[model samples]
Target: MKNHLKSIVLLVLTSVVIFSCSSDSDSSKSANQFTIEGQSYTLIPDNALLELKMDNHIMDQGQTYDRSSITLSGLNGTTIGTASFDLFYKDGLPVEGTYTITGSLSDNDPDFFDQLLVDNKLCLGWTSSCAVSEAGAPTFLVNANNPTGTVTVINNGNSNYTIQFNGNYRKYDGNFEVIGTSPVVINVTTDVTIQVF
Candidate 1:
């Protein structure tokens, strides 16, 4: 026997090269296992389920449109701050693909602020008729209910702002709409009053 059949053919070619290197390391670990799946948005910091709705809006009349709907599932677990959002590869297309979750704290300290509106129309078109509506809720001046004259605030420090509806602030000519976004026939009030300073 030629030296025992050449050492049994070099031990069967070293077991077929260790079974082809363990099948190519299991096909590169299933191609790096990437499967995010239709996950448009899931900003799970303190876990706010996330829900922000804005609707057809165009108000500037008697001004009564202070709407809001950021009911992040009623604060799921609660633990989110320093929040800033803007992530899009394609949505109202602003030629974007930006992300900023720079909050380093173990296990990534709850920071996955995701967003993908895909395209509902909104990529900075704020002047041609004014088009850039979304995220609203801030307009409250109170006196009581009037139409007299006593609105003044020359420069409370000059940040450029003087919206007064004196003598009980005639509802301060409200206009902060965004709640259900449309068909609002006026009657908007979340009840606010903070006279002075």
Candidate 2:
């Protein structure tokens, strides 16, 4: 009888251990869940690349709409800037190509200086140094001097699209002259589904 009771207790303990291990594994797997049919998807860069939080996308009657705003942030959660795009759609879907979006420096803060940084290196200086030829539609190029890269959008099935930003853009609080050494390279890929009503 003593031996039987010892065996039963051991079996119960083993079952508890197995249940706990499986529960932990399931939770880890569900952390990266992505629903293609869902309206919104979060993009977390694998290697401390740019952190983009996309939300508040509203579609218009003509299918042409404006993304409420795209929040661009640094790996350490610094607000780089907020960009808005005017998307052109045909037959109820956005055209697949490189679409230019108007992005302002420093979230359009009046107190912030107009400068662009790539990999934490000073790319574009103050408004006086790096003047925009067309104030209405300002476009920046990323190279050795400018240092920032470009963003490309690819179309996936079911209203899903992959947004690839191939550069590390940084933001500074003060003037552009205070930029320090060039930080590490950052490339991020994000998948999102746009809702067209």
Best by TM-score: 2
Q: Candidate 1, residues 84-190: lDDT per residue as tens digits?
A: 11111222322212222222222112221121122222111010010111124232111112112222212222122122111111222246222221110111111
Write candidate 2's Cα lDDT for 33-100 as tens digits.
Answer: 22111111223444212222224333333232222112222211221122222232223333444533
Q: Compute each candidate's TM-score over C-alphas.
A: 0.15, 0.30
Q: In model 2, what is the error at residue 91, expressed in angstroms?
A: 14
Error of 2 at 136 (Å): 37
Candidate 2: clashing residue pairs, number? 0
Highest-lDDT candidate: 2
lDDT of candidate 1 at residue 115, scale 0 to 100: 15
RMSD of each: 24.2, 14.2
